[model samples]
Target: MTPTAASERTHLVFDRALVRRRLARAAWLGAEPFLLERAAEDMADRLAAVKRRFETAVDLGTPTDAVARALAGHAAVGHLMRAAPLAAGAPDVVADEEALPFAPGTLDLVVSALSLQMANDLPGVLAQVRRTLRPDGLFLAALLGGSSLTELRQAFAIAESETTGGISPRVAPFADVRDLGALLQRAGFALPVTDVDRVVVRYSSPFTLFSDLRRMGAANALAERRRVPLRRATLLRAAEVYAERFADPDGKVRATFEIVFLSGWAPHESQQKPLRPGSARMRLAEALGAKEVPLPPSGDERD
Candidate 1:
């Protein structure tokens, strides 16, 4: 499985320092963390579906600490440790998104909500998660993904190109569902699975959506981002374009937020494995009640 163009830029484009600073500011604002709350709710549903219990668990960089609250009453979780990036709020642990500090096979479970999308080395991050998990340990996570913020990206690109004669990278790219699943399996995790949940939130205007993104610490923090602030003309023009194109009957603009959830487990002897391809007792043609036709012709002979 190949990573999308967006995924390819993680190491080259995202400014890690800028992302941390934005998240720190977002935490200080202490506004309504609707996105985190929603992600937390979905993670809880996933956690509930698992039949086994975890003796030790961690919440990795959940901005509003919503996941901790979600797991508070969960019987499967015996202990909960909350952590954030080095620049973010206080937590039981201070971990870098790129390199987690856990010893091998120490964690029984790890769950993250609305984080991991910004990781510079996503493959390395997945590897670290797999290494930390004990055999049969589970990792459940959610992050922004496919078609997220299409309207905003388009508006910004159009405005900048029109007003400034060039466009700057305004939005960080997110991983698609298939890429995430591939990364999980590549990280040595077993039973990897991924899916998405689309959340379309309406706002009075695109500016209001921008405000909420500010509160969520979701800012354009690309390393290659334009150093100069967006010109007032560009900002206003972008708003105009956004309203014209995305506004609904009520004059509210639409913002698409796609959350991708990934589930994987550390490899273990007890987990089910696929049988060998040729080991099937039934023949493919016989199983399908079809006659097999035999034909042999080399390319040279045919030509």
Candidate 2:
């Protein structure tokens, strides 16, 4: 395989494992019941109105439990769950977003929640998603954005810089809404839309926030990096700094999760076309009717 293709495959493998670990952690975090219940409720409400519009629907990166609940609630639409390690589920098959195993134009709807941001080649994955959807098919996704872990990131940065004299790139970078919208357009998604919602949770201390992240299985797993054991002294210093800088007036530490929601449709042939050539062109300079005067020629140009 070509280098690019090999890289893509590697990314898919890594992302799949990462997400599976996270899901498993979430399952053990005592929050799976609540999270899956909320997910099922939300999916049922959203798909109720549009369930009849699509013939085949797929949930990318869906957990087994969540998918089961969603399928039970929305039995009208054909549902297929996709995720790494294939979790124990009733999904059509295990597949990766960077390269879906479906035939082109086979799907009518694709839904993903808080999953796409973890992709190494997000644009390529989106392109694949676009290809899988039938013409005029709907695409809906939610992803954690740059603002998702501000407090945790701040604490880490402070600790590393103070203790080690430098910082480590442990956390993955996230795309903003504007950049994500531009990527959607580049991937040929029509009528693309993007919006962000902020969810804040308060913690008693920075250590509690770290514990939650670990339990959520959202720990950093950079491809090219070493995992050094964190020192207790450094961790304590980090907690102190985090509390001092990020604590609210009520003395609670807040962690923010900025989620970006996206929706788009595959272009259809029946959509309106552009105007014919030379038909009512509107140039800004011409509309302003500005005059252009020639300047004196340079010495090299003058004969």
Candidate maximizing TM-score: 1
Candidate 1 CA-lDDT value: 0.85
Q: On residues 101-163, what C-alpha lDDT tens digit does candidate 1 reach at each position? A: 888899999999877888888887788888889999999999899689999999988888899
Which regions in candidate 2 have their CA more than 4 angstroms from the true location? 1-19, 29-52, 63-84, 87-92, 271-303
Tens-place lDDT digits, model 2, residues 62-176: 5545544665646556655554334324356666555667677999888876566777778777888898899988887777788878777788788878988878765667788
Worst 10 residues of 2 by lDDT: 30-39
Q: How much lDDT does each candidate structure score?
A: 0.85, 0.70
CA displacement after TM-score superposition, residue 166 of candidate 1 (Å): 0.5
TM-score of candidate 1 to 2 decimals: 0.91
